[model samples]
Target: MTNPAAAALIARSNRLGADPKNTNYAGGNTSAKGVETDPVTGEPVELLWVKGSGGDLGTLTEPGLAVLRLDRMRSLVDVYPGIDREDEMVAAFDYCLHGKGGAAPSIDTAMHGLVDAAHVDHLHPDSGIAIATAADGEALTKEIFGDRVVWVPWRRPGFQLGLDIAEIKHRNPQAIGCILGGHGITAWGDTSEEAEAHSLMIIDTAADYIAENSRAEPFGPALEGYAALPPAERRARAAALAPTIRGIASADRPMVGHYTDSDEVLDFLAHAEHPRLAALGTSCPDHFLRTKVKPLVLDLPPTAPVEESLARLHDLAVAYREDYQAYYDRHATPDSPAIRGKDPLIVLVPGVGMFSFGKDKQTARVAGEFYVNAINVMRGAEGLSSYQPIDETEKFRIEYWALEEAKLQRMPKPKPLATRVALVTGAASGIGRATAQKLAAEGACVVIADLSLEKAQEAAREIGGADVAVGVQVDVSDEAAVQAAVDAAVLAFGGVDLVVNNAGLSLSRSLMETTEQDWDLQHDVMAKGSFLVAKATAKVMIEQQLGGDIVYISSKNAIFAGPNNVAYGAAKADQAHQVRLLAAELGEHGIKVNGVNPDGVVQGSGIFASGWGANRAAVYGVEEEDLGKFYAQRTILRREVLPDHIANAVFVLCGPELTHTTGLHIPVDAGVAAAFLR
Candidate 1:
């Protein structure tokens, strides 16, 4: 049988943790107290089982819980000592760990220990933060909870906060919880159920109050279409701007970029007051640690040219960093450490959408989640009266708290490619998409450049997340668009480490039957487009002084052409020649240029979706449906070459395997005697 206290606390933590509305990623914590035997003495002691650092509440486990001696932890608090309470508090939590738990306790462990109830739940719910940060928050909270909830002014979480909570707990034995200004709500009960229920109840009550009082604002850009542009145009716009924003927010670190136009996000941004509303500092103190006090606002006009947008992004990025440095200077103290991040985690782009940047996709999405929660809140807050968050000084205290710094310090080390960025053209689907997925899985940031932004975004979404693998639209043959796409990749991911020149268009007509338009399309994408992307991105690689890989997805038809596939074959041949030429020129600079010739990818490759494969199948006297097997059987190994197989070959070049190999084309077409090089 489980200890009743632990049972309730665990249940509550799991219940609240599962819902984003209740807690952002790892944002809230809970604790339960029960007497436990000290293994050495077999004597009962008041032990607190609390959420540990790096543990998510929704997935709490017994091991994930940090066990500490409550009495020992409370005693660590020195009464009116001249010592720094913040630093001293950390030492106490460390010392009080039961058997050291071999786990770092949650940052709020001290405060949880101070709560008098058998169970305590602290959550940064959307509703709670809304009420906590709204104008006249104290009065509104008092009105909602009456005397059941005590109101505590915002205090940085540490020993001092623990002391305040303990004093409040003792003073108001009948109180169900406390509302911390510019922070979050805390609820307590004799059982885990009561504490968790009331914790949610606090959120519900505030939500009801805000909903009843606030006015509903119509959501709109009132545009004719969802994006007010063609699918291609919309993609080009997002593709062009995403990297610029990523580069600006990077601050010399590899920042994962997420561009989203979710209905909730865009609806909020569509508001006339969206800028002012989002300008409000983070609703809760802990989120300040992830997103900073506020988001960087980018009012990039939708109609502006790509170059102008890039310039604006640069200007704003400079200003934001300068402001951040100034903010740090204002709060610099002998006790304060240097700021870890000099850039805002969130960026708001009205008339478009918003972006979240972090060291990785998970972190960036976490920031995205916080902003979405803020969107949910600002509505209710605005509906009632107004949103009022903490000022700059308070933001400084929480953002720079030693405990917060320690939390980041405890994060796991990044993967080998975590800092490297790659660009894959024609990434909307097929080999390009597969390559992007593989590179991202290996920890490299991927810029998915395709002709269709929507398809690129969809592919990016499928591979990890939108932030980790970004999508851009580029007509590789268009010099301006190709340059913009490269700029986007550089700005978004810092510098380029790899380029998969794979954008291709298959043509089944012979040169005698193919129109000039169709022939040019093939040459433009397969040959000229590859050249433009390679050339533009090469400039970035050369400037960064980082050796990079350029891998081309050339077709076996480059060397073995079918009767009706003259245009595609010739174009592919051109790309192969360019690969060798580029390898010779770039090898001097440590840039490896290689090509892979793949055959028999008719089904999942998506290259045949345009009926090109079916047309070729007719020439072979086979049904379109049998095109895959037909080609597979023709190969020497009698095996189908999968998109994943091609992707693996691309990875070989992207990784260290090709350190000494260049100007080579690895064949993935099983064994084609005509295509095999001596």
Candidate 2:
């Protein structure tokens, strides 16, 4: 418990694990061994402290480090005298624990314990792996690192690999580190600082060598973000590809979160022979454990027709899954359970960058981040020599390792709206923005659509976190823009699970004073816009074959024709009617449609911010600031109907609360008797 050597090792592991480039997620483990007094007998015994299996080193504490009897662990390996350990070796690990303080030792404990040094730091830095995964890796290590490094051939990590490393070290005796071909390197010293610093130094030297020797070639970029592509081509490509990829990735589970790559991805896939090279596998054994042996390489020609693109994407996905299954079948042992996810972690599209997905945005983003680093690794490794990662069989060992599978099992369950996507029109401000925020908070990925693309983007940023929200410029009256917005939502978030038709324009002039032009403007935006959004998004919902909800933001004036509120009221009335019509048509498709009619919400609303409040307040003989109070007092409940109130009502309809209700209108006008729903 008081070993300074073990404490230092734990601190070093945290530092190394904190950087993904140094070691992939939960991939590498470190160790320190020293003599300690037994708690019960006060007898001096040599103990080995190693990182526990399935724990992230970056956040690992002293307790997460396992202490084992050095003699017990070493004795088990000595008796085996074999290249690999069978399943029974797991039992020996428990018997060797110094105390209950240490949990199950990492699968690599035998390998760590075999090293004779007082401290050992094992890492899978991409820079070092860039060299280790090369065809000429063994020679290159000696050439770059000189006699300081010993080269070991790829061995399946277990008791045998531990014995092999020990034998290699005994023979060399002087090398500070050993390079495990197609895997990672291990560095050791008498102290944690020496081992940790030298480990990083070796990695840095390899990176410098690659940078100075390898000349990077320039290649054309791919279609990554929608804003990066031509407007006319953006929606079509995104709509056809995103959902198809989603369908492929979500064969067993929904892909609620997706991540599109950037220009670095384009540069990786731009090589003439990238398709073949990418299939070789990840740059290191650690990355292979996470991203599978290789990414799914696809062909997405920019000029292909929409129908052809869909077919092509679908066919490629099918082939990728089949290929993955074949890989699993070829390497799988009868004792090993099937590898958890058959889906490829990274999908590489030539001239189209890469795509990654997960159950949620953060996970998907993590996948993207790791894959991006993978590209860098491959580039550096290939530049030195041919990129040659560990063989597929070795990959299967790590990928299906019982320890690795346990991590996935430990993941938390999904949230209520997990894997669902929602679109909120006019989301740049007020009620729609509130609704979008609410949906995202409940676990649904949100798409924010507004007339101003800039404002839409601003709103998305303020309510930001990656993959949770995207901004789309949509003038809901324009059929093309409306369709694009819906498709954009589907493209960015996999599919549309809910809709909020909240975009509308006001024309509160009396019918006699209202111009034909004024009437058409209000009708086109409020009535027609709502119809367009619902129609386009409904098609996506139907295609998904998942029941969804659509709610319209109607006005209380729809229920009563108030003074100087003809055009606005008429438009709202038609908009309200569309809710019922949509419910009637889409109910068979399992889409429930509803409406929320609120009186006045002046705070932060564009209706008030854009000067409409001045005229309304003048008519009511009160200042503009008092308009909100006026509406509040007019309601029988005598309460203010805030934007959040409307947002709350819409959320209820979107969730299970109103799953059985449709063709319904909910009034959030506090207590407007005439506006009360029947």
Top TM-score model: 2
Give RMSD (Å) of candidate 2 vs. truth.
5.3
Native-referenced Cα lDDT, model 2: 0.78
* TM accuracy, model 1: 0.74
lDDT of 1: 0.78
Per-residue lDDT of candidate 2, residues 439-535 (tens digit): 8888888889999999998888878865788898999889999987887787676678789989976655666989999888888888989988888
Against the reference, the lDDT scores of all candidates come to: 0.78, 0.78
Query: Using Cα atoms with residue i matched to residue i, what is each candidate's TM-score against the true structure?
Result: 0.74, 0.79
lDDT of 1 by residue, 1-678 (tens): 455677667777888989887888787789999987788999988889888877888988777888889888777665435335466566657778887444677668878887778888888888888787778778887888998888888776666777788899899987888888878888888877788888888888887887777766623234332233443565456655665566566655656655556677766765567667666666676576677777887665556667776677778778888888888999978888776767767887655666787777677767777788877767766666687778888788777877767776777887756756899998888888888888888789899999899998888888865457778888898999998788677545545778999988887887688999988999998899999988887776664445678999998988985689888999999999999999999987778999999986875555688878878888899998888888888889999887888989988877755589899999999888888775
Query: What TM-score, to 2 decimals, does candidate 2 have?
Result: 0.79
How accurate locally is residue 673 in candidate 2, as Cα lDDT from 0 to 100? 93
